[model samples]
Target: MNNMSVELNYGYNGAIQPYNKQFKSNFSGFNHFEVGIRYMFSEHLGAKIIYKSDKFVNDPGGNIGIQYNSLGAGVVYNIGKKIGLTYLTRDNLGLLFHLEGSVGFANSLIQQYESEKTKIIGIGITPQYRINNKIAITTDFTYNINLKQLYGFDGFPINTTKISETGSFYNLSIGLIYYIGENKYHSDWY
Candidate 1:
């Protein structure tokens, strides 16, 4: 058996921001991409770090966007032969649960200001189901606290607000895993 598998993932989050009386308008969109990678480890216990670029476009007047570069590490321990327990750790722990205090960064464009940086910190949760050796489904729920104000025009100072701006989104994804090599068996285990 091969110890490693590679995956190609594609999915979309329906609407990011709802229509509000306080804000300008509603934000809704779809993100699509094709990424390639190499995975190393076993299904019972493994870790993977991926790099992906995502592009988002909003409606009304603001074309707010971001380019995220992240590193994630995760482990899977088989409860029996078909059931498993999994945990993933990263700087952007938005897939864990709604909470406070975490560290992450992104370059954002709000309204017409395209040269601003925003720092995000929060906690989140993700639940995943392994359908078989070749497929799995995962859902992520995250709440993010934005450290910087929306770009374009600034009326307030950096330290004016006691609490940062909060944003949350959920994603459902289906992934296909492909084995790329041979598995190494330990004599101690057999």
Candidate 2:
């Protein structure tokens, strides 16, 4: 299987606010980004390392201007090929599902609150349409859970210091993936 590839993505992302009635700064925008490298050991399975950033901002954002940066690793499964559905779309379409784990830090642009770090676990689904032998267009959707998150996006501490407090977010993106090496077809499209 020809399976080395790189991906770039950009799109919208949002975080579910801290459930507390804290004066949370509103955050919204198209500030999600992802860059990753993938390597497949076989036709149906692969692994990847990715870097992701999500920036949330608003006019006069105050603490709303926050950036979350994460580095993650995942195992990928090509569902389309795994189930013997490669006959569709002239074999130009594919779907991938992944489970990932990451560790990252959140920084506030206003410099009022101390930066906080957290571990994250997420699930993602990507649908791809091949444009050529080497390139494909893709859309991705992911949901991530933030573990032991102690601060809100507004850069303020939550009402409680419980170590188990968690937060969640979702990312929706569109971008492209480029397969590398001299192969007639990438594992995604073959």
Candidate 3:
């Protein structure tokens, strides 16, 4: 199989404490989305180019919303193969682990708040079920921390979020990955 793949995901996203007051819920519905390309150099090591977005809103009538968009580069590893799970891969199951760094902007979706530039760090794991040689289904959970964020989740100026003026958020997503190649099994399975 070849080494290229693309993924699309969408699900729930939320802002965590130190960035927001304890008054808002983190679950912002199905507004979180991600699309990315992946390439494996070997069965165990790889890299990804990603664009992800998350929208956050306060409770009904709360009149607050924020959106964050990011572009990331990350190192990925196939954990399924390393732990003697090649059998699972043969049976159409897989797992990946990643750590990424990103640069992006956050803005208030419905207010005059200015867009703020920020940097972020994230770690995640994805579990996959291959539906066929060319397609697979995956679920991912990622925890990310924002660095150099200048405002709080409420779109207000904040002195600092935490250490180094940072805030945190997370995403839980489901997606599809399409493999491009001419074999019955991609490197993830073969």
lDDT tens digits, residue span 40-131, model 3:
99888999999999877776644676778899999999998888576844757889999999997888655766788899899999998989
> What are the per-model C-alpha RMSD values against the true structure?
8.4, 2.1, 2.4
Runs in model 1 with CA error above 4 Å?
Answer: 14-26, 32-43, 60-62, 77-105, 111-166, 183-190
Question: Which residue runs of candidate 2 sit more than 4 Å off their true CA positions?
Answer: 19-26, 59-63, 160-164
How do the residues 25-46 of candidate 2 rate in per-residue lDDT, one tens digit apiece?
4575688999999998888899
lDDT of 2: 0.82
Worst 10 residues of 2 by lDDT: 19-28
Model 3 scores a TM of 0.90
For residue 6, model 2's alpha carbon misses the true position, in angstroms, by 0.2
Estimate the TM-score of every prediction. Answer: 0.49, 0.90, 0.90
Query: Is 1 or 2 the stronger prediction by lDDT?
Result: 2
Query: How many steric clashes between backbone atoms does each model show?
Result: 6, 0, 0
What order do candidates take by TM-score, descending? 2, 3, 1
In angstroms, give how far residue 43 of model 2 lies from its true place.
1.0
Tens-digit per-residue lDDT, 1-190, candidate 1? 5555555555553334322324443333345332334332443344444433334345554455443333333343332222312323211111112233323334454433333344444343444454444433445433444454332112122233433354443334444445454434211011
* RMSD in Å for model 3: 2.4
